[model samples]
Target: MPVHRPGTARREHHAAGVLLAVLSALALLLTLPGAAQSADGENVPPRGSARMGQGVLEHDGQGGEPRGGDAVQTEGVDVSSHQGNVNWSALWSSGVRWAYVKATEATSYRNPYFAQQYNGSYNIGMIRGTYHFATPDTSSGAAQANYFVDNGGAWSRDGKTLPGALDIEWNPYGAACFGKSPSAMVSWIRDFLTTYKARTGRDAVIYTATSWWKQCTGNYSGFGSTNPLWIARYDVSPGELPAGWGFHTMWQYTSSGPIVGDHNKFNGAYDRIQALANG
Candidate 1:
């Protein structure tokens, strides 16, 4: 759910072929943004999975690059089928405590690897959730949300389950705001959240970057409390929250995190995330 503001997508990330070669050649170190440094100077490797942002994660072939971090206290990763086969054991060993696997995008495309990635993360003792890439322009938000829930967004009070996330970021295609006016965008988003809440008995997490939110939804502020915010911003300090949010629930710190896709963290400590997982 990262913004596509130059260097945000395109040449940087993809599932196969040339982009991976470029990333590997760069030999970039992997770590979550603002993750605590290790006192023992231990090295952490990037998790081998595909991450979908402005694009998707690289195909797994290379080993993890060294980065500065001890064990992440409450780190998470999001992945789509593009990530290929995930080494969940390796990911857990690297301190990932939760995962959000891509389930459905818009109303039609289901991730080919949804069951494997979703069940894979849970089997490894990670709190697991699913997300949907929203396409407001294609249909009503409720339509897409229902499609997502039917596919994979359904949740139980399973101790290790997390609420579904609504990945309403930059439209990969079409107008920047997904072709809707600001007010229409806001209405569409609310429709999705409301529908998701009714279905899940819990509010869905809203994933978006600050600027994209502002531009698309006129910086709408109505959802601050009902829907927890999952802010995605890479390579910079956490910026102002989306309109009306007094605090953030989750922060996607980097796409180049210890694993593929987007690397993220809860705003609080392990205990808090533990509380989330148990619920």
Candidate 2:
């Protein structure tokens, strides 16, 4: 039997410790979630940053002023339901330049609201339009995409069909029908985007909450350079954006805006999409 030298063993152990430290730091950087406060510190991911009655002054990045010699023109909303009423003409004249409708959800579920709104209003006019897929674990990526396209009217060959969007967010707790890991969720999104683009020739747009952007989908390697981001952040002020995304085409900042013909207000954002695409 050969005996190992004590000094040599210590050197080997030290080298292994250093390698582990590097790996740990890299993982922490990659998987870091948002530092936003949660209700009871539990996970309650909202489409935007959790307001949770904080009385925080969530700023609208494009409204209230002009900056750097450019007028803020992008504005729009997402409407799947409106207090049990469908108001089409009112939405068009309200200066809503873009609208995103919920098309399909995961687990073989479809958004009845989307059909009601899209068909009810004849698909809100003039501005851009897109459909969002609620990715759940129960269905495969391609199946989920197919359900959305079938139900959301993506196959109509209508001139108004905009790019598809993947709504990647944390669902209500205990909905594990979708994969739990962020990478897995991103993989599903990428697969759906790939198939959708191959069929339709339209690349996908990614929609996610601020926390989820920071934690899960922010650094997803599956997305390519051409994908646009639709980020939702209810911040006191829209300061510097998150570090990872080089370009964000739209920012959904406020959920308290009035729309004619609807008693309850809706949420929306400023569309820098043209600038994003042009650039």
Q: What is the C-alpha lDDT of each candidate?
A: 0.75, 0.53
Leading candidate by lDDT:
1
Model 2: pairs clashing at backbone N, Cα or C within 3 Å: 137-177, 137-178, 138-177
In model 2, what is the error at residue 11, expressed in angstroms? Answer: 82
Model 1 TM-score on a 0 to 1 scale? 0.74
Each candidate: RMSD to true structure?
Answer: 16.0, 15.7
Q: Once superposed on the true structure, which residue ranges of model 2 sit more than 4 Å away at CA?
A: 1-71, 120-124, 153-159, 175-179, 221-224, 236-244, 260-279
Model 2 local distance difference test score: 0.53
Stretches of model 1 off by over 4 angstroms after superposition: 1-52, 55-73
Writing each residue's lDDT as its tens digit, candidate 1 over 51-151 gives 34552222111223324345344678988877767888988998888889988887777888888899899999988899888878888999988998999
Worst 10 residues of 1 by lDDT: 55-64
TM-scores for every predicted model: 0.74, 0.61
